[model samples]
Target chain A: MSSGLAQPRIRIPRSARAGEAIEIRTLMEHPMESGIRGANHAAVPRNMLSRMVVRMNGETIFAADLRNGTAANPYHVFFVRLQRSAEFEFVWTDEAGRSVRATARVAVS
Target chain B: MTTASRRALLLALVALPAAARADAALEAAMREAVGPAEPEEGGMALRLPALAENGAQVPLTVTVDSPMTAEQHVVSIHLFATRNPTPGVASFHLSPALARAEVQTRIRLAEDQQVVALAVLSDGRVLRATAETRVAVGGCLG
Candidate 1:
């Protein structure tokens, strides 16, 4: 298992119409080694993000299960609609059971 | 058993699954995830560059034509990298509240391979689109 600092980033509009759609972009930094081999020819144990959950005001709007095939510093962008002001929480979990989280707030008009 | 013979046996065991072919494994994974439904041609789109100078961070976008209503919406979206160490890249679950069935992300491509995006709808229909990308340098192994 590889242990390193993970940084999660999210982008959401500061405000939106009550019923309008908004795009949310997210990214996280991790090594995501494939467990194949490194330059020294030693087998590198796989370290990858396994799950991502996005919640809007305590309700899950999107969730994903990632795999080793994902590249390092995985990035995701998706859309969501809200009827009122809410906070969006993003949680990412890796293969080693480590988790990192980030949050963004949007004001619905 | 002789050391040489044991080494040969280990190599043979490793080569067995490696020789099973990559396409077949990918197909099996797709079938397992999305079932046997034949994905329609439209209702989904995959955007990726035709040529990628670096496969480590190939940007990808997938969009499904949906109204984001409770009755008709995309249930899930699955991404696959055909030539990666594993076929299943990621699976996303979405609800009607999303308003739009579009997602974007960065992925790694092992080599010149097809990156497929499959979407399943609430109405029990499947849609798919694929984009072929030629990578000058591999991402996973490099």
Candidate 2:
């Protein structure tokens, strides 16, 4: 498990047309250790982010429940159809019960 | 039993728990992600190396045949490994503009396992693929 300080960096375009589709990308710094391997064939407990939430204008757009096969430093990309300018919030909670949140603003044109 | 034979037996016994745990986690993750999608044999193509010298940063790519338009598009792609701690790899959401219905990335595999990739279509149909990989020691073995 990573230290409590790590968090995902969320990015959303500053401005988007009211009816245009926008791309959202999220990147997190995590070891994603499987906890099944060690330097000398020992058992390590699995550590990874279990869930992620993406909200647009306070409406949930995307939610994911992650598991062991996830790659280290996991990166996720998703798209949402923008209806109006709003604040997009992305948050993730790992299996260790740590939470990190980020926000991006999109202006409708 | 002789010392060498005893050691071998001990190792095999130890492996049982890890294997069982991996199997359970993989099953649970699959159930949660895509419930009973008629587990296909190899409908999707997984492009990964035969042997990963470094387990920490193995490149993984998955592609499926789909026409990405307003009519029908791939809604998502999920990656999974049987032996990895989380069993569930990363996932991506696609749109028509993505053009190619493919995803590429670097992943960590603790050891060999049946890697499964799943694709959910716009019409709520699920397609899956699997690949077996042999992993070695090198990455995140702290």
CA lDDT of each candidate? 0.82, 0.70
What is the fraction of true interface contacts found in candidate 2? 0.32
Candidate with top TM-score is: 1
| lDDT for residue A46 in candidate 1, whole number 0-100 | 65
Residue pairs clashing in model 1 are: none
Model 1, B46-86: lDDT tens digits are: 99999988888888889999997999999999999887767
Candidate 2 residue-wise lDDT, A1-109, digit = tens: 3548476776678887876766676788887656655434337566778777777678765666665455677776555666667887788888878888888888888
What stretches of model 2 exceed 4 Å from their correct place? A1-3, A17-21, A38-47, B1-32, B39-53, B59-77, B83-86, B90-106, B111-114, B121-124, B131-142
Flag regions of model 1 displaced more than 4 Å: A1-5, A38-42, B1-20
**Per-model TM values vs. the true structure:** 0.86, 0.64
Per-candidate interface DockQ score: 0.53, 0.23
For residues A54-90, what per-residue lDDT tens digits would candidate 1 score against the true structure?
9988888899888756778888888787799989888
